[model samples]
Target: MAALISGAIDLGGTKIEARLFDHAANTQDMRRVPTPRDNFDSFLAALVGQIRWLEQVAGDPSLPVAISIAGLIDPRTGIATASNIPVSGRNLSRELGEALGRDLPLINDCMAFAYSEAHGGAGEGAATVLGLILGTGVGAGFVIRGDLPPRHAGLAVEIGHLGMPARALARHGLPIWPCGCGRDACNENYTSGTGLRRIAEWAGLSDPDPVHVAGRAATDPEAARVMEIWADLTGEMLYSAQLMLDPQVIVVGGGLSNIPGLPERLTGALKRLRLGQVSLPDIRIAAHGDSSGARGAALMAKAGKA
Candidate 1:
């Protein structure tokens, strides 16, 4: 018999990516296609096509699929509701599974990221893990002894929306910008790319992107100052999670995590607040980097974790 194959799709607003992974975490036929945001039929077709492609390449007739989405994916109902994706409030998994004749597992993107790291990535070997993304937004996924709950409704580790106290923002002299969620001064104001842009303005910057802010932090004193404030605010954010969940290891992913030396800086901030930490929990960058979503989707399919 041909080796059993596992597959996954990372569904994004702009693109849909499908990947196949062997038991060893090695990938094959990684493929990407435009997401048909306007039409649900087109979107489903894109996913099915990718699955067929991967199965053909691997010579497996029936490939199990698990998906990672940026928003809430309810495996029970197979419905998805994401802010950016147009297909909000639709039975994505159930409908897709009907088309494919199989019950597909679906997980939130953050959970997938966390599951990936927890199983074999940076968070490997840790009983409790926080898979955090410090990129366009600040969010996390919690894994308890490798169990990732599938029906989070996208709110389990949504750390970005938690507001930073006015007192905290006062220290950095940053303005209380309104969040997309209609709240003023949510954590996203200081921890997301938009937040980074706003923080950069405090250092007299204009429209600086996350990459620009991270790159200049090394050479420019003003930029360095902003990052310090960013780190402090972020530290505050992570500290709250530590107090609540007390994850054993934190694996940082996303665009901001790629900044050289940032992982160390974030580690220091978390450790400082750990309160006489007995061997501070490990904080490290994501080992699989951007591939965590797709890879984790496959893993969840193979393990039935979702």
Candidate 2:
């Protein structure tokens, strides 16, 4: 039999990355193009073009394709909702599959990240892994034994949308802020990289970029204080997540995870909130970096084929 190969696409707000990979997650060929933001038709065309290009490069017209999209796809309705993409509320899977004459599995990007880490990246060897992303916004994926837990309505693990703990908000004198999701006091408003900037601004800092704030944490007392609160708020969320999921390992990814000494600071905060004799969960940085999404999509395709 011919070696099994699959095509994967990582669909983000700014760009779409397509790759062909073997069963082992090795990249065979890859291409990238700007994501179409003007209309759904243009966006669909871009995906069709990328998949066709991949099939041509592989010389296999029947290659399975999977997408890791920065959005949610309701399994019941096949409708997708992404803040950055134009496909919101559309049955993207059906449309794209019809255009290509093949079934295309759509996985949430964070879920893909978790699957990738659980298989061979940071969460390798762990029975349950929580892939946490702390970038412009916050999101997470829960995986157990190399597979995601069953999800209903595509929202089982939307931890970012949960409300902030009232006590924590009161402690920091922070007001409940509105979230893009049309809810107030969502965790994303206070724990994301954007949230870090919000904290900096609240503290009267001139620079609100999370990178600059984290960089100045060492010498700048105000910046240090901002990060401290950020860490505390972030830790509060993780504390609840840890209790709920009891994951064996928590893999941190996304831009904010790059902050220096972040894992240690988070661990410290967790220690402070320890309720009993439960051991602190192991926290590690993501190993696959940006490629994890695409690689994971390919892996999902390959697994489905099996």
Best by lDDT: 2
lDDT of 1 at 59: 79
Model 2 residue 218 lDDT score: 100
lDDT of each: 0.80, 0.89
lDDT of 2: 0.89
Which candidate has the highest TM-score of all? 2
The TM-score obtained by model 2 is 0.95
TM-score of 1: 0.91
Candidate 1 residue 163 C-alpha distance from true site, Å: 1.6
Q: TM-score per candidate, in order?
A: 0.91, 0.95
Residue 103 alpha-carbon offset, candidate 2, angstroms: 1.0
Poorly placed runs, candidate 2 (over 4 Å): 1-4
